[model samples]
Target: MAGHGDSFVDCGCSVVGQAGGEAAATAQRRVLARTASVCPVCLGPAPAERVAVGDAVLLVKRCPEHGEFSAPVWRGEPAFTGWVRPKIPTARRGPGTERALGCPNDCGLCPDHGQHTCTLLIEVTQRCNLRCPVCFASAGQGGGRAKGLEGLGGELGGRPGDERHEGDTRASRREDDPTLGELVARLAVLRPRAGDANIQLSGGEPTLRDDLPQLITAVRGLGYPFVQLNTNGLRLAREKGYAARLAAAGLDSVFLQFDGPDDAATARLRGLPLHADKVRAVEACAAAGLGVVLVCTVARGVNDHCLGDIVRFGLARVPVVRGAHFQPVSFFGRYEGFGAPSGASESAPGVATAGTDDRADDRKLDDLREAARITLPEVMRAVRDQTGGLIPLAHLHPPGCEHAQCSFSGTFMAHEDGRLEPAGGACCGTGGSGGAARDAGTGGMAPEPIPAALGAERARSFVRRQWRAPDPATVSADTDGARGGTLATPPRDDFERFLARAGRRFSVSGMAFQDAWTLDTERLRGCCIHVAAPDGRMVPFCAWNLTSVDGRPLHRNGAPSRTGVAGCGGLGSGEGAGA
Candidate 1:
């Protein structure tokens, strides 16, 4: 593996010490694009550039006081320049806040932000039942003040008097879970601002709250069409009727934390052997007619080898398991013992230990870090390799809704005999008369380029239809609507035949989140996932979870105080709610 700034010649020789000093090494690098990022040490805005070195693309930035920092953003196959889906930047309908500070710092969905809310995450609580070592929110713990905002006070984007004093009541208030009335008020404020965005009730573990059924009912009552739960699945597995109760309460989908097929992977990542419990949870969801999407946190050298197995497991479950979603591990929140350097005892359990070498320098340490970090292209190739071409590289397409670099998705129709056929319109080619090209999956003409706004709207509809449990009434109407159970008019065409088995559709997608080391303000501005803040504002997902190297948050615990805006008050002081 190559380090962050390492460069080499075609003949594979190191060119760092050949006598031209620093300028010689700098000449070998090719600058790709200029953007803005924040320093991992200080959380201050800095100018950054994407540069290609060897086969990797690194995001390199320098803070005047903190010096230079570099991290690999893309590496190997599918080529960075070729994996682009250009979008006509569409701003939000009504700006939530003024542009006071800058891009990420002024994130009240300021007028300059370039995307609408595809999914609005409302964290119902900051408490959890399990203490997983890889939590992004650092949940199930108490930390009143935002460490990243310490001392800077109002200068860091809050109002003049918004700074917290030593004995302020807000600090203690941070520990209390929001009451039901408070959540209803928050939903009323969000219903107008978010306008038709999908709702996800996230938490330390949302199941920990006894009123979760009530919360789901409340969300649906406010006219949000879809409601999903992000959970670990312990309660759903152990409590017999829990899944049915949630389904009856108007819940549509379950984003279950299912790491892999067996205990070997779960014990290493989740601190216990939970494969059996996860299976039972899925079965329970199936029994209750609730659709489930298996969510896996892909960590390099740990569960990276388990992607194919996870996909196979989901496929075996068919309509009950709607999809498999993989997320590359980002260095933030609670990933303490996982990414340590070579020879450290704090390495995650069951991982192979590296031999001790006192001669390891900063560059060698950086190589280890880069090796631990996995890129989106690498994951795509891994899926191709691990699944033996069941999912080919050509079938996977750049996301139509988000920045092309953020994700890749493919839809497949599963057969009863365990074969997957790529559905048409999976790829979003460039849009216009000239944009039509050959469809890689079917050798036919492909769909034209999709505008960003239209792409987002279609994506929301697709998720609602595919990820929700099949409606019994609609299924009966399609399969047995005729008298005496005969087809009304036989099958007209192959397209109608395909629609007959629509319940078998399955999706495979991966999302690469940005951490302090990988944050690119360009990608941040195009983000479609937004978090609804207690202060009656919407913040982009990445900006809300941005934290320094030492776990100090930028916006999670430090949102501005709530104003007297109608239906926006009384949201409790709990911090960092969503996954």
Candidate 2:
């Protein structure tokens, strides 16, 4: 078994017993645990097992109709079993819907859920400005809704009562952009249910809306404390004072879609060269006193190798560039040629890359899919390896709000000398009882259960305090001097210097969203980030985005109804929000 500090490698671990002629490989494997999953082909519930082989863990499941599926969930260092953060399951209070179905099928935040909402995403529109090859929401112009009858119930599968009448015309079923009045009504209904959970305004591209500032104002007016916009910075870079207008509207931060450090990385992932626009957007946000978090969609052989460069770039911007968040690509919405076995090219122009050409063979394609995945452990190791251990594996801890395996995050203090030192606090730990010695394979000791509600609250508070830009009034003059600006008077003492440096906190984190291929019911049940559906139910983020291999959605464009709330008629008539 390898340790966290070991040199990063593919390890080439495969699913041994998943297919015939691999009987010899099964002898070296071990079953670690059992859980529930959904078939990637049929979207039906399937019993699954976590199998450990070499230093990796693969999620293996067999659908009665769709056969077997396996994908790597963890790889390389920090050991899968040891990375545990146990939370006492929070009882679902005031559930939005009754459990007519089970687990994911009954995902209106049914009583079976194990965690509370930390961030509630509201997709404002489905119309996007750019066409990225790897979009989870599959956003587009003219709306991404299907044509004619295909756009209704059968293709866009949903729970009961989500079906539209056959006589409904294409004009009637059109996924229109929600009006300001409709959004306000929906928010009013969700306010009592969501409490103070952070609000993220997302869409095809949120900046596309001219009345975006008004929407932000409405969110703030409704008493939500923090509101962040999810966008690609094209508009902010092209239009002067755009960021300032958003700031004036009471927006706290910008979740900028920043793929990598250079244009080549952007071109490969996002269809065109966008590095310059991303930089200008950051500058605009900085000028407007708005905090920005650089979000990178990490795809294998694309931007995964540049994680270190992205972090270094964010650090150079300091308080304005508050954090860097990485998301490993999941095959759900518009990934045309993501995991295709060799020779298949991505649908986006010039965005194509190498993949296995085994599409004709189902077993071979499954093997390729397993090979293409870049798991959470792999991402943690990449950060450490690419940054030359500046962000050590020990410093990165499992999440407190979401499932332990879903993400990892750490905060570092950036000093004038360009060193990133770990700002260890309650969030940093092996999450175990006492100071027990870590096991050889698992990175830490068995975790002791903490209150799930406490974890959710703590995560919400941390993001609110750390993700926002440091107040200009409290920033010491020495801080400006550190960034090459002149200081009227240098820090008088070491304490002042320490205070100045402490104010420059930079966060590094990565989240692995489960796709149909990797949908773990246990993880889904414990999800903290949720989406606010038009029908007034808070659906977990993954559940809202989950799609089968054929591209039929489980919840996206779900039929909207007005039964739950008062005064909000014609709700769910339009498309929901996304990022």
Candidate 3:
């Protein structure tokens, strides 16, 4: 970030471009030749199409049927905030595209996850009670070298026989190890100070874990403060007081997988009919006074017809069902060989893409901006209508962006109406696209213009920040002894100091979390910074060695990050059924 001075490149269409990807000259050619003119949702010409505005090509798309969205570009700017914010490139993994390859697939952000990220995506378990086709967790499988609690625990650099964390060049983790303390200690290290640390409790149905309550208690015991659970609803719907029991276990909310109503949606998405049960689960949670965040994976072909309906469902349950996150199908685990039909006369840019439904490969970052037909302000206006109320888009200014132009990052909003106003929705890699602002003191900042170069990369870094794939080099021998990655540890005194700055004090109510939201992530990421433990295991809440982008210091999880963490469930509470 220091020696490099090549900030903005000339989209060359006019002024120089920012430090993102290609400039206007290249972007225009890509969209005109490879992109389409219709809205990916309704298959109609995007509303307010903003094409070629100086070095940028803005696209403002709104649909009465689908959600509202906007993409703007100004390739002619200098580097993103002159090193104040820089993109952290994701390491290419064993098998995956070079990223930046999905945007062309649709009008959404880069399928490479153009935006949004949760530094820590705590999936309590890869096991689920119900087996659904589109289940993102890809859970509900049997044993036999399964990566269960230990797999999860090792994420924090502590999993049992956890010797690899020692940092010994020769030290490494074994194949199987399950220790809870190492995980707890690690979480204590990663727990964000100001913002709630996100912990998504997933499962072969966490309720199935007889030790579910104890696990929840363990996470609560740790100072997580915020917790969320992802479930199929079998336990909560059928079992009476199931939700109550979980609430009593110190659960904050549930990111229930409610695709649609009736068995139709359930069958289509889950490959089984359980709509009734799904509704029951939602109701049960509401009855138990637990916040509910509906999780829907918007498949282009599978449940294409239900997009609008899902929004309405969330709107109807507003306030109680805080919000809903829509993830366009990701081609992973179970979705590996999946394919979506592109035969529709007027389909999205890359409708026919296989196993890439989630990545916007149909539309590249350049294409999305070129196809920009909607604006944040405009999208908000439409959202207000869909929600049957005024969901002023202004309410959703990309809260924690890494760029000056709010749009350069992704889009996100702090909306009360159950749907994300986040930079981009989870669907089509939405959350981290727009780089809007929020008050610095109160988590609000004024909207700024976007620079081209920083747009895609900034968004990528955001997603990487949220990606769950830990470094294999860091795990092993912590809680669940298993071969894994290497991680750093946090200082104890600094951890305490960070917590104090976050205004987080335990309430006698026995609740560890209360009103956590994405305010200033820079000030909250302290929780994620950590030091390598004596044994080389990654520590969770250790709190030392954590510093801000500028060494200013930040709390963990910021407000917006908190929502994803809490909604996914079981984050703050790391223990799953096995725990």
Candidate 4:
């Protein structure tokens, strides 16, 4: 009865819904509509339809060469059809490519592509220290296969791609990694076009690069409003000064890979008992004035149960731990299995792409169903159940910049006793000089979906004001030495004091990336997260990770060209790219 027209709720204004009872009944019976898709097996174009299966929506399509396929794209109470946010169409221009290869291949934000760039993900390397059972990037030792080594698969035990020869280590892969100058130039390209786009430094552990601080400083100098570091936090825990160096270099946020709260969860996902180390990493970041967003790769039977606990943990940390982001596993890259076996030992076969029983381990993307994966509605339901219903359904808002069904966000105010209240409407606390319309509280109403132009500024402000944690001096003394970091600092400055007052409010948000099986061109048209490619073009993040049936990645264009930097020499970022 309290329903209102807002981003979170669809007004009963649809032509069919508002039509006569007879018309409405007929509309309800209409279960199929056309869309577009890609065959997971061949990565070929396929005509698709949205078929209503009970309350869930299934994308059913057929490829000339790959046969028929269907995957669950949406589900839950209201039905997927009614969950769409009003479309906000931006100006469309011709794509950078000549339109030779079509929808995905014309990926230089091709003319047919629907959206402008929102968040630019700049991958710095293909090397990683740890090898996980499920890795989308296939990031491990030896720069993840040579330039064009495709179709190398067998089973667990051998190298990542199951290549006969041992791949290059992190040290051996440095020459191909993007340099600071090249990254700066890439950002320069986005400045005039995308305009103040948020840049996230990602790849086989961005922190592994010793010159990260230098890179962060370089990124900031180029006038990018927000610079985020995506890392596993292993380096942050071991190197006490690492977080501080990043902060001093103008790093705005750390997207830390936090699978769950226990050592077992860490070992299952990351192949090590990293719970203690994750905590230390959070503490180090908090002490050094860096905001952290816990990024949990949510596997259904894996660490999905810990979603609520992860949110509570983040709320307890307040301004420092800004949010917890949950990503339902999208079967892409080198992912081997759906869920880890119970009591998975350290020596247990990982979910690597190189599994011998390829059919048993690798999910044929074409055969994927709604039951095979977790959906956003399911995740929200789990979070609500975990928190005892304190997290209101209305608090989840349709994304302002991305596809409505792609993601949802909720903002909350943290209490000293660990209770979290939705920060909107009647409960929204008094605020400062910031815009009240954009305030956390709007009477529990969802904020209107914003266009790309406005979304960028709003994103920058949110990261600066809400993501940055409160001054350490104002935190409860009981949390001291909890993470064992040496970057603690004395509180100083009026700005810090002012931010402390506004820091209690933080946000929880996530985006479900579409893999090849769920590749809908409609969703692609609305994508805002773009991966910066070496060809000086921006490819949608999902498209970049989408792989062909033969295991060839769509947009992984290799390392960008270096500018005036010295040749890649010396022992770079000491993490061995060994499995």
Residues 269-309, candidate 4: write the lDDT tens digits: 66667788889889889778888889888766778788889
* Tens-digit lDDT string for candidate 3 (1-579): 000122121212432354543474344532311122222232222233334545344333333333333334323222122212233322211221222211111111112322222223343343444445443323444221222233222221223442211111211122212234554565555443212334555443556555667777788887655556767676788778868888888877677777665567666666657777777776776566566666665443455455446555644543235455544343222222132212112333232334344234433422322222222233332334544543333233332322222222122322323444333342112232222222212343323333322333343343323222222222221212111112244324654433222211100000000001101111212122122232322222212111111111111212102222212221222111100
Clashing pairs in 1: 431-449
**Where does the lowest 10-residue lDDT sum fall in candidate 3?**
506-515
Measured with C-alpha atoms, the lDDT of residue 163 in candidate 3 is 26
Per-candidate Cα lDDT values, in order, are: 0.67, 0.70, 0.35, 0.60
- Candidate 1 lDDT, 381-468, residue by residue in tens: 7877888889877778777777878888778887767789976545222222111112222334434445566666766777788788
Error of 4 at 84 (Å): 2.6
- TM, every model: 0.79, 0.82, 0.43, 0.76
Sorted by TM-score, highest first, which candidate order results?
2, 1, 4, 3
TM-score of 1: 0.79
Best by lDDT: 2
TM-score of 4: 0.76
Model 4 local distance difference test score: 0.60
Candidate RMSDs in order: 9.9, 9.3, 19.3, 11.6
Name the better of 3 and 4 by lDDT. Answer: 4
Tell me the spans in candidate 4 whose CA falls farther than 4 Å from its real position.
Answer: 1-32, 92-95, 142-161, 164-172, 339-372, 425-452, 471-501, 558-579
Best by TM-score: 2
Q: After superposing candidate 2 on the true structure, give the runs of residues whose Cα lies further than 4 Å from its correct spot.
A: 1-12, 15-24, 142-175, 339-371, 426-447, 478-499, 559-579
On lDDT, the stronger of 1 and 2 is 2
